[model samples]
Target: MHPFVSVVIPAKNEQGNIGLLIKEISEVLHALGNIQFEVVLVNDGSKDNTVIEAKEFAAQSQCQLQVISHEASCGQSTALHTGIFHAKGEWIVTSDADGQNDPADIPALLQAAQQVQTEHFCIAGFRNKRLDTPWVRLQSKIANGIRQRFLNDGVPDSGCGLKVFPKRTFQALPYFDHMHRFLPALIKRINGKIVVCPVNHRNRAVGQSNYTAWSRAWVGVVDMFGVMWLRKRTKLPRIISEEIE
Candidate 1:
């Protein structure tokens, strides 16, 4: 069966969380009733048993689950790219492997995407109340302020893992190391609409964060400048009409 939506999750060492995350996703998608959904879990060279746990859950899962593995650890952006590229669904939903992004919010994002008139669009989740350390939150705030001022993509939380967009829109964007963080800006560069939806955020139940605030900020600053350059050079043509004889 062809899925209407595919949830792509990137995990490195999330053995404890992978099974639970997939179960939650299955429950949520099953409740939607009319929607046909699948889960694509990309195991990014996990040292732990992340793949094993995911496969165990997939055996009993009502939803279709596909597990892809990377021989070596690539970054989250590349794992996301791999999952989305292989996904069968037209609509792709991204979630973190840490189980912080709530599965219940997926329906709302899909609904928002459906409401958009244009085919090229993105629905980014806005985490109004983050459940993280004060220091981490502060760092994120500073980074977001800098990003917003420069990109002006009008997305409040581009870092939020819960996002809904079409696979075609994502494929059209240029692939980069940290392109995942600048999705809103990239979508805008391609003349796509951005919609921000308020979603639930939770503290991590298990496993440490793969990246620190400092690490993210450092790479983010560089990637932000790169996106700015791409934005400046981007020129979208306006086609008036097409005639087929």
Candidate 2:
């Protein structure tokens, strides 16, 4: 049977977390035996044993599991796009590899999707109180504020990696570097709805973060303006009356 949901996780040098994360995801999804699901772990050119660990767990996973590798380190957006492109499931869910994103919250996102009764919309997680350093949280807050004001996507925590969306909807979007950070806005550009649900945020217990608040904030500044431009030029027609001749 084909998977109903494809969980795509982007990992870069997350050897310590990949195995545990996969185990947690398997356990959580296995409990929900009614639904068919697959976990796709994208190894974003990690210079560690991440690929090995993932492959080991994939071999023993009860549900379908796939591990995709990149020859060089691409950004998170590219890794996610690679996994999404290869995903066979109708629904796509993404999460971080640092083990901060709880696998238990996946069902809630699924429930939200069912409750809304739409596959074209996105169900994103809102980390009410992030388990990061105070400075990190402050950076996120400022970045989110600026993004919300400019894109008006109405997403409070756009940086949360946990998001549930339809695979087709994601594939339809114009792909670019750092696009992962602006998914809600890009989805909105196509007139897709955004639903934010409060999700658990855990402290990173293992590897150090690949990103820094200063670097992300700086890059985000540039990406935000580009998104604003895309939003301005977007023309999603309210009415379409196309007929084949």
Candidate 3:
């Protein structure tokens, strides 16, 4: 049997884009055919009508659509956590709900994950072909370069908004603010082999990003330093004894 795939979307103020995103996923992939899938949308306290439209989409979608809302606006990492927690599918696929991450590219990621026996664990996505503002792209390049130099992890595009992973893998990783940025490296820490493929990136159609360019740059400083701290603090668990607590 094909493993169930959960399509997790993180939305802030994407009222216009959320409905379209759901429709696209249903048409392209998430319709319940040979494989089972679910669309889990985490509305991070959008001031717009995002939640209402998302709920309507859930009512009609062929794939079970679930809407989770945050009482107040939290970061994207929190939204990620909420979606993953609600995901019942064995394989979890996360994408940006701002229309930047194409639903059509999901098949490619799924195929790559399955090829590598992803039932155990794997995070797959694009290494190149990212579409965004020149400044956004440049910022990502500098951030990724710094991460690669410090972490020595060979993730090409860690900032790409599209990723596929086994739900179990997510269960194993430690949670941190902006942890989404270091998914590839975190996966490696738990002995997971992260895979990369080319995924289509589209321009934003609706709401603007919640984060500013300068804040993104500043967060990189904190995140990089924190990651370095984690590297030092990590200790391998030893099998002391098999006694129940």
Q: Quick one: best lDDT, which candidate?
A: 1
Candidates 1 and 3 compared by TM-score, better number: 1
Error of 3 at 133 (Å): 2.6
Clashes of 3: 0
lDDT of each residue in 1-245, candidate 1, tens digit only:
22399999999999888898899999988887888888999989899999888888877776698889999989999999999998989999999999999999988888888888887889999999999889988888888999999999998887899999999999999999989999989998888999999999987888898877788899999999999999998888999999999
lDDT of 3 by residue, 179-216 (tens): 88787777777667777778787888877888887787
Give lDDT for model 1.
Answer: 0.91
TM-score of each: 0.97, 0.95, 0.90
1-245: candidate 2 lDDT, tens digit per residue: 32399999999999888888888898898888788888998989999999888778866776588889999889899999999999878989999999999999998888888766554689999999788888888888888988888888989998899999999899878899999999988987887889999999998878799977788889899998998888888886665686878
What TM value does model 2 have? 0.95
Instruction: Assess candidate 2 and give its lDDT.
Output: 0.88
Clash count, one per candidate: 0, 0, 0
- Best-to-worst ranking by TM-score: 1, 2, 3
> Which candidate ranks first by TM-score, i.e. highest?
1
Poorly placed runs, candidate 2 (over 4 Å): 1-3, 240-245
Candidate 3 C-alpha error for residue 189, in Å: 0.6
